[model samples]
Target: MSLLNGLPAHVLLVHVVVVLVPLTALVLVICALWPQGARRLGPALPVLALVTLASVPLTTGAGEWLERHVADDPLVRRHAELGDGMLPWALGLFVLAAGVWLISRRTPAAQAGARSGAVLRVAAAVLSVVVAAGAVVEVYRIGDSGAKAAWHDAYSKTATRPGDGD
Candidate 1:
């Protein structure tokens, strides 16, 4: 069985990663800042993080495969480079989500302890916020670059077609 069955996997998987990663980041930030929200989300945050993390590598691998089959242009290369940088941010958000989940699971007494009480919770929240912010920014960067690479030339060509007015 062929891996992609003659289709470009990148075209199929990029959408999932693009949508899920930012969504996960937003959820992570919300859970971090809101205790009741975190309680309601329960196990969902970590699971979302895991899925987002998994999707990144898949999207990247597909992108690499697609890259090999396409002409090397500055826009595509820039998008590829930006895409390669996404894994770390995705991984960081995953780690932060896991950390937040673990911290939230501790007992009331354990959370109230001197070392692991309010201070730890605050620290986790702050760190989660920072990581979530970074992840969101990275997602925007990747999406913007990818969109530009994918459409810039097509739009340019269309605009410059014969008999077309400026």
Candidate 2:
């Protein structure tokens, strides 16, 4: 058998990292912050955040080309829209982290400033929460499309079957 498959590396990379890793990290973030246990589970927060953040641009850019070439279907369109929305949220979080990193360096020891306080914390939490929620929604959507897309062959089979075409 030939060693190389026809699948593109970009497509493979997108499925593995962008879709799975970020969602896994998002879940890990919540798990790491679980109320009852020690919070040692999330050592990779910064790394996870950075990876997820960096992927925003790459995914969206690849998507732009994919959208142009792929067959235009309602499901694909919806998927594109959902994927597109992730860019801004990811970029915003990355920007917020940068701002916090800069200002934290200048702030005093006793208080890390109000940016780490309830207001800003809550806002960041809300933004990430929304992004996570949207991701979940999109996952369900993608899953549904997968199910329907699988049926396309069966669908055509049934349509053409047993004198159906007359």
Candidate 3:
């Protein structure tokens, strides 16, 4: 129910994805402005694009693995569902990252990409804010729900034993 128990080794990388995927995209967005500078930075947008894309699968896989062990309470399910809902968020960011990469590299296409980048950057900022807020709400909701569920299960089990009376 806490970070230690809630987050496990198997899905630890998933947490990394949640944090890093956006990070890379944001960085790429900045780098997109200076293609020459971005080129000097590292492997380029293709690699960054792949890394961003990889997070989607990694996050999903890790979450599914974690969910298997966690109890199927609504609160827990809600958290899992939250992750599911973010699939689109992650996908959009990845797409934007890819576009930024292309625009930065493609001189002829840079104008269109720059326009798209402007829009993408704004969208990224908005989504980042929204996602951060959503994560907080989901965490709080899931925690409260899990606590209630745990208590309910404990109470029911206590009352159902042969020697126990409600």
RMSD of 3: 9.1
> Each candidate's lDDT (Cα)?
0.83, 0.50, 0.55
Backbone clashes counted, model 2: 0
The digit string of per-residue lDDT tens for model 1 on 90-129 reads 8988998887777777776766666746777788789888
Instruction: Give per-model TM-scores.
Output: 0.85, 0.52, 0.53
Q: List model 3 lDDT by residue over 1-166, tens digit each.
A: 2134566543455555556555665565565555555556645555765665666566656666766777777766765665565555555555555555554455645546578666754564555445434444543453455356446555554445566343
Displacement of residue 36 (Cα, Å) in model 2 is 12
lDDT of 3: 0.55
Model 3: residue 104 alpha-carbon error in angstroms: 1.9
Best prediction by TM-score: 1
Which of candidates 1 and 3 reaches a greater lDDT? 1
**Residue pairs in candidate 2 whose N, alpha carbon or C atoms collide under 3 angstroms:** none
Off by over 4 Å in 1: 1-7, 113-115, 156-166
How large an RMSD does model 2 have?
A: 7.2
Residue 28, model 3: lDDT of 58
| Residue 78 displacement (Å), model 1 | 0.8
